[model samples]
Structures are given as structure tokens and as C-alpha cells.
Target: MQWKQNLNHWLHHLPENDPLKIELENYQSDDKLMEDCFYKELEFGTGGMRGIMGPGTNRINLYTVRKAAYGLSQYIKDQGQEAMARGVAISYDTRHLSKEFALEVAKTVGAEGIQVYVFDKYRPTPLLSFAVRHLNTYAGVMITASHNPPEYNGLKMYGEDGAQLPPDAADVIIDYMNEVKTELLIEVAEVKQLEKDRLLTYIGKNEDIAYIHSLDSIKLNDSANNKDLSIVFTALHGTATETVQEAFLAFGFTKVKYVYEQCGPDPNFTTVKSPNPEEADAFTLAIQYGKGNNADIILATDPDADRLGVAVKDEKGEYVLLTGNQIGSIIIHYLLEQKLEAGTLPKNGVVMKTIVTTELARAITGTYGLETMDTLTGFKFIAEKIQEFEQTQDHTFLFGFEESYGFLIDGFVRDKDAVQAAVFIAEAAAYYKAQGKSLFDVLNDLFEEFGYYIEETHSITLEGKDGAEQIERIMESFWSNPPLHIGGIQVVEIEDYMTSIATELPSGMKSPIDLPKANVLKYKLEDDSWICIRPSGTEPKIKFYFGVKGKTAEIARNKLRKLKKLLLQGVHV
Candidate 1:
């Protein structure tokens, strides 16, 4: 393969004292490892770039990071002097090399005569979003892999609006990244020089204080005493422990307990196989603490604290982990009900969710007479809608969520916030507790009122360059050979997002989809169940999302399992 040639070239040219050189020497005997490391450059997408940490063009290292930073700097320069002066707000989570990468981006920007504001140390991803708006920076960058494994790390760039870079802006950065031949040869400003020139600033506590105060606005029951609620929270060995604890206490939640074992900044994530809350095992320790302390709820955030996972006591006192959809459903009901009663619900109020999220959100928000809008599957689209609301004044963005546990309760923080969700959900539990109802009970009540709606996501992981190609073929297969039926249900309608059209099966009727075009295909069944297929934007997986509403939970589970099995047939990615 040409990858060997690339490896030999790097080995010959890379400096002897370079840190990545040692990593190359260790793997020199392994051709497969060398191919994977040197085959191709990591592409920065709408969510920015992420990869395994090592030496090579394919890996996330100082050289590749420098290239990304150089592109970002040039992009800022292209935006004009005002944008360069406004600068970029930078932050990192507790992942390894997070601090170094944050500084790397900072120095690159500063070297180009652009200002840079960075956190003193590790902070959650949401705080970075808040900082971008708080500091009035031209853009923002966060160093994290979110919930990826310990060996992986990433860089996510955000625009001035505090959302992930939209398509138009991201294209500009990619264009600049393409022109750089040698990523490691980039220049960076010295830390001392930047500081002396006032081009680099350290953002410490004051911005955090502003964020904490904003969380106060999310409390539905501001006057409701939180004494009755007990919370067990774990940061999963990443960021969010201190900020969450402080915010909880400040909001009058005094009985909060922490899972001490998982609180430290251990980059290996020794406690769990994967530190992702979407998996049941992530909440193992937190649930144990919840049971021991008789806590009302258990909360777990990913490495960056943008995504939240929840576990609540069921009727039999079993700690049942709630899906992202379920938690979002509960939060929506609680927040909107309070806002409605207080006569605070805006006349033009709206709730937003990704197209892949459960329609249960639609039912709940519709009951409140709030308009519901669907964006392509990302929190950035929701944030875009929030920004649009501010300019047009046509609709007030009341709430936004994705089925992946990313939620933005208000526009105060433009990105998904687990710190905000943690405290707010605790308050929600307290509100329900005052009525002698558990969150599970509230969920059951919603099911009874709106029928039992169950949503499940099935993902097929494919890795490296070949896997990316296979994922594309799988998407192409779904597009060309559309299924007639799934799990005994007829495909009544198909929405091909890539084509931006909805087609009715029998009548052959068609209508345009208004949202941004994406590589997603959704089929609505005759029985009201639905299935969506899309390649995950952040990870190397083809995700199939299923949602079914049945008269009973058992029926929904059976239907979901059957459909998942059918979809898995002949698909090996």
C-alpha cells in the first residue's frame, strides 16, 4: 500500500528527538499498525476532528493538531481583523493531552496575531459553549473526545454563536487545512510573548460564575424546597464533578452524594469498560451509591459533560436506567407544565428535537400547544434554530433534545449541557417527590396518557478507511433497494433526507423536506412504528433508530426486537 511509503517518508524526515518518533520505532515491526497510522489524514467534520492518539497523519497528535489550528487561524484571518481581535475561547476536559492541545490551538491562533482566551485548567464542554458567548469571542475550540475511549481525543471548533461550526464556515476551514503540506512545520506564538502582548488571556472563575447563575433560570420550581431530593452523581472520571456539585448546592439541593471512586481525573477510565453513559454499565457505581444513600436519582455525564445519563428508582425500588429519550420526555413535561401554569409559556414558544428523536416529545410539546420542529440529527441544528429565533422573533425556542442524551434547556448555553441537565433533573425529581411521585411513575403516567412509546438505537461499528467505504455502501444499499416491509409492518412512507423528499408508497405522492440535506433514510410503517438509518457523524458506526408506540410496553419491546433483527440481516458493518 502507499501507506508504507508514507511511513518510510515520515521515519526519514521526522526529527530524532520528536516524541512521535519513539512511538513509530515501537510499531516499526508491525505493518498493520503502520498502515492504520500512516494511511490517511484525519478529516475534520462538522463536529471537528477525532482519532486515536499516536504519531502519524491518521492519528491525532501535535502535528495534525497544528494543521487544524493553522487552518482555524487562517479562517479567522479571512473573517477580517475584527474577528481576529475577538479571538477564540478554548477549554479542555480531563482527557490526556487535553491541556496541551488546548494550548497548541491557542498558541497557533496567537502566533497569527489573533487573541486567545483559554481556561486555566480542565472544564466541561458546556462551559466552553457558554464562554464563547460570554467572552464575545469570534470562535471557540474544545479539546475532548466526549465519551470515546481513553486512547482517543479530539478537537471541536465552535462559531461565534456558540454552536458547532455550521456547514459554510466548516468548509472554509477544510479548504485551508488542504493547502498545508507539512502540519508539523507550523508556527506558534510563545506563551510569554502572547501574555506580555495581552493577545492571550486566562479565563478563570468569573465566567464559571456567570454560567452557574444562568442555570438558576432552568429551575422550574425555584421556590420548591430541594431537601426531599437526594442525588448520586459521578463524572465518570472526567469533567463535571465540581461544577455540578457547586451548582446543585447553590440551587439548594443539599443532600447530593457523589460516587467517590469515579470522581478523580483518571484518563484510562478504569472503572468502566467504556465511559459512555448511553451504555448501562456506565451507571454501575453511581447506581450503587444511589441505593446506599437512598438517593432519588443517579446522574452520569460523559468525559466532557455535554451528554447526561440518568437512572431512577422504579416502582419496586429497582434502579432503572432511563434512555435518552425517556429522560428528555420527563424534562420536557416537567419544565413546560411549570411554565404553562405560571403563565410564562410564550405564545410563540417551541420545542425542538432531531428527526431521529422520539415523537413522544412532539406529543408532550403539542399538548402544551407549543410548536415542534425537527432538525437534522445534531445539537448544532437545534442551536441554529435557537439563534434563528432570536433574529426572526417568530418562535421562542423553549427546549431542544436529541435521543443521544444531548439537551439544551435554554439558550443560555448554546450546546447540550449535562451540568444544566443534572441540577434541573434533580429539581424535577424534587418537584415530583413533593407530589409523592417517582420519575418512573411520572414516565408511566406519560405512557398511560400518550400510549407506550419505546425508542431503541442499533449501531454497527466499522473502523479505519475500508470501514468508511463499507459504511457508504451500506447507505447506498438502503437507498437503492428500499425495504418493502419490516417486522410484519408495511413501509407506508419513506423520507430520503439525502434527496430531501418524502414519498408515499401506494399513491406515489411526494413532498419536499425543508431541513438541511443529510445522508439519512427514514421509513414510516403502517402500524405507526418508524425506522431511521444514518451514519453517525462523530463515530464510525451505521446507526439504525427505531421508535414504536403500542398499547402495551410488551408489544413495543417485541416489535422493536423483531424489526432490529430484520434490519441486521445481511448487514455486517
Candidate 2:
């Protein structure tokens, strides 16, 4: 009944001839669909608002975009005239309505007397982060869903540092968003008027040139011969085309080939079932191209170009897709080794990763005498650490990555950067090829040196209000019961991040976890394997992460399968 009231309010406030009004009218007869869209306002999570594109309070549409932009405008204005003068930089992806939503944000913020800088075309999410810092803007916004389905689109806000807004800043914006009583009543200025008033500016070629030039700093072996290393790159119908092309050229990667079918912008992602490079299927075209050309390595970036996936040839001459963990470990080893050889390795170097990522990174960093620290699940938290290192000077930030295909090699861009990763992955490939080895060989060697580390992620999707309730119930169930053994391995430690406490099993000794509180649980077994369960922050899914180590790949895979089966058997929708 309350959903009906909310639906009626939208129908009344929206213009009779508006497209959303007609769409809402058509869906009103479907009770289930209507309730799901009108039951509540779409939440502005720590990363920002994301949802399906539709006509309800819970969907992403013009009015909701206006509401979010207005909230950001109010927050900027509260920071004083200087903040408003600094303005916000905005960019979008290849998704449908992405550019339109970006313009809507510009107009809404401009209406509040705030300046705005918008890209002339859709660009990578990291470039938007670079623009915020490059232009000294007060904030930034990226219109993208990252690697979500075609039906999904969302907006992610960035702080001045170009990282996703931290929790405290996000909370302020969420409070401002809640203060708005009527989304439909939010006013937006005309793009023409904003341009005439000089409140809006379009950024393109110059900014891109600056971004590409910055890649020079991340290149560890520019002098290494790259012509012999052939690479296949696929942008997956996203935004990495121009940047990746220029970057490879700048780095002397002359033998690179592009998967033209998936290079340009396609809102539907017609070339692949999904645009996510993390999925093996997304590399379908790249693999064909790789085999035909006998390429040394293949790389793919998601729609927003913030994450990368790599594939390399194994000793058997078969192409093997490397997991995010493996790619990160190889990069870490190459970076430290090259730096040490050149006598440029910093004494206080540090590598940052998420708690859910593989521990092999720690093993690698430890050997180099570099510190390895764990953050929560988001790259934003790692970005926050980068900012802290700048102020403290106690540690020199070297690299940061998460298990979900995201990586950041340099702090110039506060978010994960596939363009940077692409350059480095290729350089590493070339560097290894000179020694008569493949990227796959390098990964195996690292495993041989640091034990076999395997990681897997499983997700369960549940939609609508009922689905939300079910997720909460599942989290509560795990919190209350605290399993004693998983896969028959004795649990040695139980960490409840939600409670910010870690209890040593059997001993019952408790210690505080000096990290931000989140709804996550981690179980450490006596055998050095670990499992983490947490609700997805950006999607309608709950994810389970499992990691294990062994002397060989076969043993590690078997242990991982057992861990997944036994723990997942206990979780229910």
C-alpha cells in the first residue's frame, strides 16, 4: 500500500508527456515490479548509487540523477565559495544513457552556481579520477556500472584525491540526499545556459595527452625491446580504446593487435555476453585473435577500463587465463626485482591489497623487505592509504590491487587503472620473453617459490525487497552460529568485521581489528587456508571468497573445491 502511494506521487509529479511517466504507467499494473521500484529511494552506498534503469524511486533515471547531483551541489556549497569555484569533473562509460546522465549531473550541479568540467566523450573511470586532480576540481563523478550487466547503470562519486568518496564524505552526501523531500521537484539548468554562463567546460584531447604522458612514470622497463612481444587487446565495447592504443604506441609496443569487434562503444555489449573481463567468456574474441597471431599475451579491460584481465601461453603452448591474484603477484615480483637490479628500490616500499586477496602478495613483498597491508574490499580504501603515505612519508606506496580484477600501479590516478596495468602487463611479458619464458611461466615460478595459492569467488543473486530481507537473514545466521570447522579443517580464528573483533578459537582470546567496520566474516583455519563472506556493496548479490595454498596446483584446486562445497552447503537463500 505504501509503495502504491509512492508510485502515485511519482505519477502526479512527473510531467504528463515525460517518457518516464509513460513507462511508469505501463508498469503500474504489475504489482511486483512497481513495488520493487517504489518501495524505497535508491541507497547512496559508500561507492555511490547504482541500480537498474527505470522509472521508480529505486531506479536510475533523470530525476534520481538530479537528486544525487543536487545533494553533491549542496555539499560543495556548504564547503564555501572556494569549493563551489573548484567545481566537479564528470565522465561516463559506453552504457545506454551514460552520457545523458552525465549531462544531467552537470546541469543540476551548475544550477547551484557550481562550476563543472565534463569530458567531450565517454572516457575511462581512471581518467576521470585523473581529471579531478589534474584540474584541481572539488570532486568527480563517473557514470558507470563497472562490469555489471547491460540492464544495469550507476554513478560513482570521487573525492578531490580522485578516489571513490571515503565513508565520512559519503555519509555527508547520503544525509544531504535524504534531506531532499521530492526527487521530481529537483530543478536542473539548461546545458546551453550553463555553457553561456561559463559554468561548464568540455575537456578532451589535452587531458588525455596528459594522462597518457603520466604513464611514463609507471613504466619499469621502457628500454626493454617490446617489438618481439606480440599482444592482443580487447576493450570489450567499453572506453579503453583510444587510451590503450596511444599508451602502447608510446611505450613502443608495435606488435599489438586490437580485437576490433569489441573496441568501440556499444551500450548493449553485443560482442560479449557480458563486458566483464574477469569472466573467461569475455575473452572469447581475444583468444581467437591470440591463437591466430601467436601472441605472447592477451589483455582485456571492462567497460569503465578500471579493471584488467590477462591471458598467457603456458609451457604446453596452450593459452591460460591468469587469475587476478596471479597477475598481481607477477607484477609485484617484476616490479621489485627490476627496482632492486637498478638500485632504485625504496627502503620503505609498500604494497596494499584487500583482505580477500591472495596472501602470495605478502610472501612476495616480504621477501623484498617491503610492507604489505590489507584494506577492506574497495579500491577506495587502498586509495585512502595512498593519500596517507603521501602525508606521513613513512612508506612509499608502490602498488595496490584487489582480487576482483582491479589494480592501481601509481597514485597519479587514485582509482584502479587498467591502462597502467595494460602497459605493465605487456612490459612484464616482454621482459620475461627475453629470458625465453612466458607470463604463465613467470606465474608458475612464483608459485613454485611461494607455494601454490588459489582463490575463487562465488556469488548468489537475490533481487527485490524480499531478496534484501533474505540477505540480512543469511548474514545474521552466520554471525550467530560461527562455524567451528570448514572442509574438516579446524578453525583457528574467527574475525567478525561487523563487530570489529577477532576471537581466537578454542582459546577464546579476543583482539580488536584496527580496520573500518563492515558486514564481513573471515575464518582462518589451522592449515593456512582462509574463507571470507560478505554482501556485495554495489550489486544485488552476496559473495563468498575462498583462498588456499598447497605445494602444487592440483592439490590447491582440490582444497579450494572442498572449502567451497562444505562452507556453501551451510548458506541458504
Candidate 3:
């Protein structure tokens, strides 16, 4: 069928209450707007699905949510009665309509005769991961868009082991979702009926208590007490405020202050341009609060509370927001130091990071006779490794982190736990304070020891269907005509994860990559600089990551700037 004809069919068939149809009605004369809305179904990538909130086959709304849930329900039922009995756990952040979508998912799965454990109120993404394992659910679902804007929302699924469904499992779910024909006909058990049947359970405060207790176990250096140290925290108007504040108090920090303006859950994230803690602008209000309170440290979490971001008072008394790489390095150094000192550092201990993360973590890992493994740029692979460790090997999983503000310490939850991270980071701060040092001081010491390793992520947002094709074309262009050098540095090695091949530029020799296949390309430069290109799994954006190491911070910054220019140039063509 012609594209316009297919669109017209959907338009005519769309329900009157459908937001997409309503918007389309207003745009009837605007062919471009109509085409954009009906161009294609929103792409469901490995990170689950995310898009602008609306009603359409190509948007994230009630109908699409129901279809995805129906697909998940079918997948569970196909696994047999035992899987259905085991049930599914569902949670949601404070995004618009997040709770409604989560309840809809529960109803859809309930109609399949599967049990459902739905959180009674807003919760963090990691808690959903924890609930999956704690309740022994067959799968888990979290309705969140992570740090995306207010207009965006998403759905993420996790397998029985509490990790995001691996590619093979995700493919199966995607197939079933695509096969779903009509959203209106999607089967969903009435909420009251499911509740009466005892098939829909509402998770409550007890789970939160258990989760916080698990976070308490993450403290490796309890003997170091620094109750006098002042700190400020912000949830960026999301769901972490109460939990983080409580965790800090539990860790014996008495001077913690919350950013009042952004303390409560605000779906619109009214104050900040973006709810993402990774950006310095997101912490503006928190910084002001920190300065006023004489805070030695500042912490912020994204909307879903899965990723953590921090700032510390430098020697100049200015609040400086640390990059994800810098925070990861500090955490690694602190954890290893305390563990080794306490003689609890495992001989077979391992740490996991993404390919785009700073190599400083690897350098720090080596100092304590520990090993660091690299995965693609997602926390799921790190979660996969934690599961791998529990099932096989004796290697103790000490910590896992990604370059994008996500970190995990204890394996109680498979995904990143900012609540847990906040606890440990507070403990780390207390540990430093006991020695009369600030987190900034500790970070500087780490840089001095591991060389100044700096990393930056540049993302290019391309909207609509054409943007996706452009991203693919750009990636293919790099693969077909690989760079010989970047920023005048020799390309020593190229790792093509899609082909599972790592080729040595100098020797022209290739070796198999030990990790799972991904649509990523990395160029390792001779001067310890690297560039990687990968499309964002949850948004219409392509990311260019650059990491450079130098004897000094200025040199590292310079190298990163040159590499950034080269990367932009490569993507432009």
C-alpha cells in the first residue's frame, strides 16, 4: 500500500478520543505533520520503547502501552502455567501517566491469568528490578523515560533474573508486539476483578524498607565517622528525595539538606530544562542550596532514580559537578581501598564498565589486583554480567557502572540503583571527611595516580524517521571507510562490536571480541585517546563518545577537543 493510503486508513480507524487523531485532525492540511505522525510505528529498540506521549501507532500512549503489555502477557503465557503463576512486577516513576500505563500493563498481564505485583505508589527503576528478584517474578516492567524531557515517556522490561531482557528474549517480545493487530481489542482484566482474584498485588512500604536495608549493606567502611560534614541533595523533582534523605541519615550524616523547591515529584520537572542530573544546569538549584548550607558535597538523581550525579566543593570553594567518569573513578578507588584495607577484597573480584566509560576505572582496578571488563554502552550488559557471576564463577561482583551516570554496587538489584549509589557515595564522603579531605580532593588524588583521564559525550538529535536513516548511514560510512587517525594520533586498534572483531591497525591482525554483538564502532588511538559511535537506543539521537588520557588535565582537554572536532567531521558526511 502507498504510505499515504496506509496513513489514511489509520486516521479513519483511529478512535475519536485518540490524541494522535485529534492532533491529526488539526493538521489535516499540513501533509508534513500528518506524515510525521503516521510515517511508521515508533521504533522499539534494545532499551525498550520511548517516544513523545500521544495516541497513535507511532506514539507512546494508552493503546501502544496496552499492545506492548499484551505482547508481554502472551510471552509469559507461552512460557507455560508455571511462569504465569510466578507473576510479573511492575513499577513506575513520576512521569506523566506513568502510573496509568503501569496499571494498564498489570491489567493486560492479569487477563492472561498471570499474577501481577504493582507498586502502590511511585518508585525508582532499581526498586522494580529488586522487586522482580525479591518476589521471584517471571519478568519486570518499569514505566519511565529515564532523563528524557516531559514530553517523552518509555517502558522497560526485565527478565526473570532481574536484568533487562537480553537481546534474544527482547526479540521474542518484539515479535509478539508487532503481531498485535488492534489496540482496542487488547485483552485486559478489569482492575477490580484482578484485585478480587488476588492476582493483582499492590507492593507497599515494606518493599521500600527491604530495599533501604539492602543499600545499608553497601557500606564497606562503617568505622569512618564524619557526622559533622554538611551535604546537600536534590532529586531533580523526581522520586528519590525521600529515599535519599533517609539513606543519608541512616549513614549517620546529620547535616544533609534537601533542595526544597525540587524536593517533591514534579512530572513536568518545572524548574530544570532537563531532569537529567548529568548536566550541570540540572543542579543549579541544588548548587545554590549547597552553597547556602556550606555543603561539602551535592548529589542529584534523574527522574527514574536509576542514575546518580554529584558535585563537590573544590579547593576554590566552588561547587563543581563531576562527570560520570570522574564519579565512577572515585567510587572505584574508595570501594577498593576500603575493601582491601578490611581484607575483604576478593582475589577474583571483578568490575564492569561500558566501552565508552573512562579507562581510568580499569587503571584503578589494576592497582588492587582486580579485573575490569568492558561491555557495550548500556547497564543491561553490566546486569547480565552480575547474573553470569551468580550462576557460574567464584568471582565476586564488587561494582558495576556505565558512563551515563548509572552505577550498581550490590547485586540485590540487577539494574543501576541510584538509591544504593547515594548511600555509598555519602559513606565515601564520610570516609573522606574523617580524614579531613573533601570528595574533590579524593578525585584529584585519583587523577594524579591514574593520569588525567577525561571523557565527553556529544549527542546529535535527529527527529522523525529520516533522522534514524541518517544515523544508520553515518554509522555505515565510518565502518566502510574507517579512520586511519583521529586528532593526528595513530589509530592503533579498531573494535567493530557488530562483527565481533578487533583489528590491530598497525599489524592488521584481527581477534574476536569477547562481548555480545552491538551496533557500535570504536577507534583506539595510539596516544591513549579513543572515539566511539553508537545510536541512542531510547531516543532519536546518535552519540559520539571521546576519551583521552594525559599527564595533565589541560592536555587531556585539548586532545578531547581535537577528537570531538574529528568525530563531528566524520558524522557530517
Candidate 4:
């Protein structure tokens, strides 16, 4: 009955000729659909909000976009006149309605007399983050759903540091968002007025040049023989093709080829089932191109160009997609070895990875006498560390990555940058090729030196209101009664990030966790295997991440499979 009343409110306020109005009218008779759409307002979390695009309050649309922008605008205004003068930088990806949503954000923020910089056209998420600091803006907004399906679009907010808003800043915006009575009543500035008052400006090539120019410092080797490395790249119909090509050219990588079919932006993602580079199917076209071109490496970036997927030829001459952890291991080893050779390796060097990331990073950094720190599961936490290191001058951030294909090479861009990763991958490939090896070979070498490290992530998708309740039940069940042994391996310690405590088995001794509070749990096994469980902050799913190390690849894989099965048996999907 409440949802019906909410539906009626929308029908009463929306214009008769509006597209959303027509959609609402057609779906009015569908009770289940109506409830799903009007059950509650779309959630704006620490990373901002994402959901299906439609007319209802629960869906992401023009009104919800405006409401989010209004909250951000109010938050900026609270920071005083200088914050208003510094303004916000906005960009979008290749998703449907991305450009429209971005323009709406600019209009809404500008209406509050805050200056705005809008990209002339679509750009990657990292570019948006870079534009925030590059232009000295107070905040930033990216209109994108990253690698979500075509029907989904959302917004992500950033701070002055060019990273996703931390929990404190995001909390203030949520408070402001809840004070708004209705999304339908939000107002925005007209385009003509925004331009006339100089409250809005469009940025393009010049900013891009500066971003690319910054890459020069990330290079560790001269890499004059760039022609030795052949690379095949696909943007997955997203936003990184031109920028990646430009960076490659600037870095002297001329043997790069693009997957023509999936080169440009396509909201429908016509060539792939999903635009997510993490999935193997997303690289189907890229793999074909790589094999045909006899390329040494294949690269793919998601719709936002913030995450990268890599494939390399093995000994059999068949291309196999490398896991995020594997790619990261290769990059770290290359950087550290090259740095050591050049005598530029800092004694205080540091590497950062998420808790769920492979421990191979730690082992690699340890060899060079560098420290490795683990953050919670988001890039924002890693960014937080980078910021801290800057003020304290404690350690130099060499690299940071998550297991889900997101990586950041330098602090110039405070988020995962696929353009930077692509160039580095190319450079790394060339450096190895001159040494009579490939990336795959380098990965195998790392595993041989260190033990074989394998990692996998499994997710259970549960949608709708009932699904939310089920996720809650699952977390409670695990927290109240954790297993003493998983896959027959003894549980040495259990960490509950929600309570910020780690409990050692048997003794029940507890220690404080220094990281920020989050809803997550990690079970450290007697062996070098661990499992992490957490509800996805951006999607309706609970994810399980498993990692294991053994003497060989098969041993590691078997251990991973057993651990995953043991825990999955207890969780009801």
C-alpha cells in the first residue's frame, strides 16, 4: 500500500509527455515491479549509488541523479566560498545515459553557484579523478556504472584528493541527501545560464595531454626497442582506446593493435555478454585479435577504463587470461628488479594491496626489504594510506592493486588507472622480451621462486528485499558460529572487521585491528590459505575470496577448490 502511494506521488508530479511517465504508466498494474521500484529510495553509499535506470525512487534516473548532485552541492557549499570557487569536475563513461547524467550533475551543482568543469566528451573514470586534482577542483563526480550491464547506470563521487570520498565525507553527503524531501522537486541550472555566468567549462585535449605527460615519470627503463613487444588491446566498447593508444605511442610502443570490433564506446555492449574485463568472455574478441596478430600480450579495460584484464601466450602458444594477482605480481617484480638494477630502489619503498589480494605481493616486496600493507577491500582505503604517507613521509608508495583487476601505479591519479597499467604492461613485456622471456614466463618464474600462489573469488547474487534479509542472516550465522576447520585445514585465527578484532583459535586471545571498521570476516587457515566473506557494497551479492599457496600449481588449485567447496556447503544460495 505504501509503494502504491509512492507510485501515485510520482504519477502526480511527472509530466504527461515524459518518457519515465510513460514507463511508470505501463508498469503500474505490475504489483511486484511497483514494489521493487518504490520499496525505498536508491541508496547513496560511500562510493556513491548505482542501480537499474528507471523512473521510480529506487531506480537511478534524472531525479535521483539530481538529488545526489544536490547533496554534493550542499556539502561543497558548507565548505565555504573557496570551496564553491574551486568547483567540481565531472566526467562519464560509455554507458547508456552517461553523458546525459553527467550534464545533469553539472547543471545541478552549477545552479548552486558552484563552478563546474565538464569533459567535452566521454572519458575514463581515472581521467575524472585526475581532472579533479589537475584542475584544483574541490570535488569530482563520475557518471558511470563501471562494468555493469547496459540497463544500469550510477554516479561515483570524489574528494579534493582525487579519490573516492572516504567514509567521513560520504557520511556528511548522506545526511544532506536524507534532508531532501523529494527528488522530483530538485532544481538545476539552465545550460545557457551556466555558460553565460562562466560557472561551467568544458575540458578536453589539454587535460589529456597533461595526464599522459605524467606517465613519463612512471617509466623505469628506456625501452628503446619497443617494436619487440606486440600488444593487442580492446576497450570493451568503453572509454580508454584513444588515451591508451596515445600513452603507448608516447612510451614508444608502436606494435600495438586494437580490436576494431570493440574499439569505440557502445552502451549496448553488442559484442560481449558483459563489459566487465574480469570475465573471460569479455576478452573473446581481444583474444582473437591477439592470436591473429601473433601478439605477445592482450589487454582489455572495462567500460570506465579503471580496471584492466590481461592475457598472454603460454609455452604452448595458446593465450590464457592471467588473474589480477598474477598480473600484479609480474608488475611488482619487474619494477623492483629494474629499480634495484638502476640503484634507484628506495630503502623505504612500500607496496599496498587489499586484504583479499594475493600474499605473493608481500613475498615479492619482502625480498627487496620493502614493507607491504593490507587495506580493507576498496581502493579508497588504499588511497587513504597514500594520503597518509604523503603527510608523514613514512614510505614511498610503489604500487597498489586489488584482486579484481584494479591497479594504481602513481599518486598522480588517486584511483585505478587502466591507461597507466596498459602502458606499464607493454613496457614490462618489452623488457622481458629483450631478456628472452614473456610475461607468462615471468609469472611462472615468480611462482617457482615463491610458492605457487592461487586465488579465486566466488559471489552469490540475491536480489530484492528478501535477498537483503538473507544476506544479513548469512553474515550473522557466520559471525555467531565460525568453523574451527575449513577443508580440513585448522583455522588459526579469525578476524571480524565489523568489530575490529582478531581472535586467535583455542586461546581465544583477541587483538585490535588497526584498519577502519567494515562488514567483513577473514579466516586464516593453519596453512597459507585464507577466506574472506563480505557483502558487496555496490551490488546485491555476498562475495567469498579464497587464497592458497602450495609447492606447485596443481596443488594450489586443488587446495583452493577444497576450501571453497567446504565453505560454500554451509552458505545457502
- All models: lDDT? 0.90, 0.93, 0.87, 0.93
Where in model 1 is the C-alpha error above 4 Å? none
- What's the number of clashes in each of the models? 0, 0, 0, 0
Error of 4 at 176 (Å): 0.8
Candidate 4: 10-residue stretch with minimal lDDT:
220-229
RMSD of 2: 0.8
lDDT of 4 by residue, 1-573 (tens): 788888999999999998999999998889898899999989888989999999898999999999999999999999999999999999999888899999999999999999999999999999999999999999999999998889999999999999999999999999988998888889899988999999999999998999999999889888686777899999999999999988998989888899999988889999999999889999998988887899999999999999999999999999999999998999899889989999989898899999999999999999998999999998988999999999999899899999999998899999999999989988999998998998889999999999999999999989878888899999999999999987667999999999999999978999999999999999999998999999998889999999999999999989988898899999975
- Residues 1-573 of candidate 2 have per-residue lDDT tens digits of 888999999999899999999998987789999999999999898878899999989999989988898889998999999999999999999999999999999999999999999999999999999999999999999999999999889999999999999999888888898999989998899999999999999999999999999999988886457888899999999999999999999899999899989999999999888898889999999999999999999999999999999998888888888899999999999999999999999999999999999999999999988889999999999999999999999999999999998998999999999999999989988988999888888888898999999999999998889988989999999988989987678999999999999999889999999999999999999999999999899888898999999999999999999999999888887
TM-scores of the models, in the order given:
0.98, 0.99, 0.97, 0.99
Stretches off by above 4 angstroms in model 2 are none
* Model 3 agreement with the true structure over 436-509: per-residue lDDT tens digits: 89999998898888899999999999988788889999998999999997656799999999999999988999
- Model 1 residue 270 distance off true place after TM-score fit, in angstroms: 0.8
Model 2, total clashes: 0
Candidate 3: where are CA atoms >4 Å away?
A: 1-3, 18-20, 223-226
Model 3 accuracy (lDDT, Cα):
0.87
| Candidate 1 residue pairs in backbone clash | none
